[model samples]
Target: MIFLRNILFYPAFYLGSVFFVLASVVSIPIGPAPLRWSVAAWSRFHRTCLRWLLGIKIEVEGQLSREPVFYAVRHESFFEAIDAPAMYDTPVTFAKHELSIIPGWGRAAKAYGMIFVERDQGAKALRKMVSAAREYSQEGRPLVIYPEGTRTPHGEAGKLQAGFAGLYKLIGLPVVPVAVNSGPMYHRFWKRPGTITYRIGETIPPGLPRAEIEARVIAAINALN
Candidate 1:
């Protein structure tokens, strides 16, 4: 029965995503102000679909940062990337430049302030991230980043990337370390059909040197293990 449910669920989820993409494209040239709230609304709907369609429940512990801050999250499953915008009031992600090459999804990402990074052009990517993060922070939105650069296969804590440290120093904002355990349960191919927990830690206040901040983020997340 679970297998049957999974088979039926994916198609509906795909259709919902298509509908969202079409709706977002039609809404874009109108400008970001009006579209911002709508995007958040749709994201919530999308997260709901994932909850029902995929049977993955999410639990968030601790409080999100009170002020505009940067979130360094552990990436593992597709669930976190898709579900983040819904979890926060306004979220701006730092994603790879390749995501923009994708046809439909890329457009939606652009509308929601997804900052694209060119991995090959490291200096340019850091500069862009700083600028976007400053702008988004001023708007009182949290900038979300996967410091590991890519998803860990099964929620293992991967080596932290230097890009996060660079961004932390550039933006000079508080860092919120989010430890997540998503793979033993909601992994894509071997998904266990259960809950995924996002354990948020207290904001690591700014003013420390970049290395210290990076260590703090890593320590906070590792504490969850």
Candidate 2:
């Protein structure tokens, strides 16, 4: 049954994404608002497919903050990444430098106001990401980042990446640590039919010394694990 559902989902997800990708690409020439709208629509399309087609639903633990702030999220699957746009008002997401070079998608993401981090460039990349994030915050857009830097298996605790602490300190926004158990239901080729819950932890104030803030964030984001 799961295999049959996946067979239905892969085609719909990939082929549908192509249309949105083209829409996003075309909107680039028009301007930022249209480009962002195209991308957000694409994200919602993914969520709708996940829920109705695959029988996977998302449930929230705490109130999702609408105020422009930094959201430090758990990394379990690509589910949360897609869910960001569906849940926010055009969030500013942190993405890998590699994704920003992928032909049509790259051009669209760059113009859509994402902060690209060249993980290999070390400190230079951090500086660039911080600068971009600050600009987005000033525009009252919510910024989202996976503190562990990449996906991890469900129920496992992954170490917070160094860049996460750097971005949190430099972005200067109160961080809302979010824990999402997405792997159990959303990861793998054959996804399971279940609920992926996202727990929003208490907001941590900015400027609390590095050690204190990092510890708090780690604990909060790992609360579900």
Supply the global lDDT for candidate 1. Answer: 0.77
Off by over 4 Å in 1: none
Q: Candidate 2 regions off by >4 Å?
A: none
Q: State in Å the error of residue 94, model 1.
A: 0.4
In candidate 2, position 18 carries an lDDT of 93
What is the overall TM-score of model 1 with all chains considered together? Answer: 0.91
Find the number of clashing residue pairs for candidate 2.
0
For model 2, residues 1-225, the per-residue Cα lDDT tens digits are 888889988999889999999999999889888899999999999988888889999888998777888999998888887888887788999978888888798888888988888988988878888888888888899999988888989778888887777787787899999988889888887898998888999998888888888888889888887
Give lDDT for model 2. Answer: 0.87
Task: TM-score each candidate.
Answer: 0.91, 0.96
Q: What is the C-alpha RMSD of each candidate to the true structure, in Å?
A: 1.8, 1.1
Candidate 2 matches the true fold with a TM-score of: 0.96
Per-residue lDDT tens digits for candidate 1, residues 119-176, read 8887987787788789989989888998888888653558878777878877988888
Model 2 residue 110 CA deviation in Å: 0.7
